[model samples]
Target: MTDQPIRVLVCDDQELVRTGYVTIFSAQPDMEVVGEAANGLEAVHEATRLRPDAVVMDIRMPLLDGIEATRRLAGPQAADPPKILVVTTFNVDAYVYEAFRAGASGFLLKDAPPAQLVNGVRTVTGGEALLAPAVTRALIGHFAERLRPGDPSRTAREDIVRTLTPRELEVLEHIAQGLSNAEIATALFITPETVKTYVSRILAKLDLRDRVQAVVLAYRIGLAGGAA
Candidate 1:
């Protein structure tokens, strides 16, 4: 962790939602609410000026929208982007997929418990990503359903799988199955700490940004599928 607090920018069109987040996060000593934006355009401007460590962004905002804002801040065009957490009140599947595709580091339900919210911020700030179990499964399933023989990136994904050690490969398969770290450890008879280490190593070896990416990779490489 850095010596300074984890700075956060909260963006939500609803005043109550923004106030709620600010109130909850500001109570923590390790984090601080650095700024607030009512719309996606303001979010981009505030993000540029404040450069907060993480952003709690809502998907539907006035003017520009979370998807476009996220794309601008953490997408392909970004030079140096801050981590973004997409927290929405809805559980619409398309929204979840779009949030991840937009390069958000994490996704959370707007009503998630305070602890989960806090942990989500910390996870992204630590250069990791977080997705709900349902969202994770959806991402993998989405990719597998569209799998094609002549896909241009197939070979690259296969190469990523080839680099994984035997143990890491096992972990990857379980991740695609939507198992949590503790559950994976229990099923494999390994310690959770060991599972954590394996997960980190798998991400490094596979050139994945986080577990979410690892899940997608597993499905892409045919390790996890309908018959998996």
Candidate 2:
């Protein structure tokens, strides 16, 4: 890891929640609060200027919404998007799904324990998607709908997936199912190092940005329906 502490931008409409995040991040020796935004539009502007290592985004705000802001800051069109970790008070699957589709790296509940909040920023900034055990099942369940055979992107996605080897494809399936390297190794009777190697190879071969995109791709091509 870099010697510099992770820089973070905290965005929320609620004054208390925003302050709480700033406090939590400030207390971490490995993290620093670089900026704060009270609304989504401000979030985009501040994030653009501050270029923080990670963004703690809240879903609902006036002027713009967190999902749209996340899209603007981290969307496929962004030249160099920062890692974004969306924090929501409600367990709305649609919002969570939209956040991911818009390019957020991860998400957690506003009521998540302090340790979870701290670790989430670190996890996302370190380039891992931070879907908790509970978030994974719910989020992936919503993610699966993007593959419903009738979606327009399915054909192209299917063609793109043809690049993977059989072994890489197996690894991709486990990733989409939210299995960690160790868990995948256990399930496949291989070493975690081997699983990590396969994961890297799969990402390189598929031209994926990270495991999150890999999961989306797996679901889009119908590889996740029963592949898990």
> Could you estimate the TM-score for every candidate?
0.85, 0.91
Residue 1, candidate 1: C-alpha displacement in angstroms? 2.5
Which whole-number lDDT from 0 to 100 does residue 49 have in model 1? Answer: 96
Model 2: lDDT of residue 44: 96
Worst 10-residue lDDT window, candidate 2 = 145-154
| Count of residue pairs whose backbone atoms collide, per candidate | 0, 0
Which portions of model 2 show Cα errors greater than 4 Å? 142-146, 151-154, 157-161, 226-228
Regions of candidate 1 where Cα sits further than 4 Å from its true position:
134-150
Model 1 CA lDDT for position 51: 94
Local distance difference test, each candidate: 0.80, 0.83
Write the residue-wise lDDT of candidate 2 on 1-228 in tens digits.
Answer: 989999999999889988888998899899989999999999999999999999999998899999999999988899899999988855465687778778888888878999999988888887677468456766687657655644555675566567777778788888888887888899999999999899888778877767777877677667776422
Q: Give per-residue lDDT, candidate 2, residue 228.
A: 27
Predicted model with the maximum TM-score? 2
Could you give candidate 1's per-residue lDDT for residues 13-97 as a string of tens digits? 9999899899989999999999999999999999999999999999999999999999899875787789999987654546665
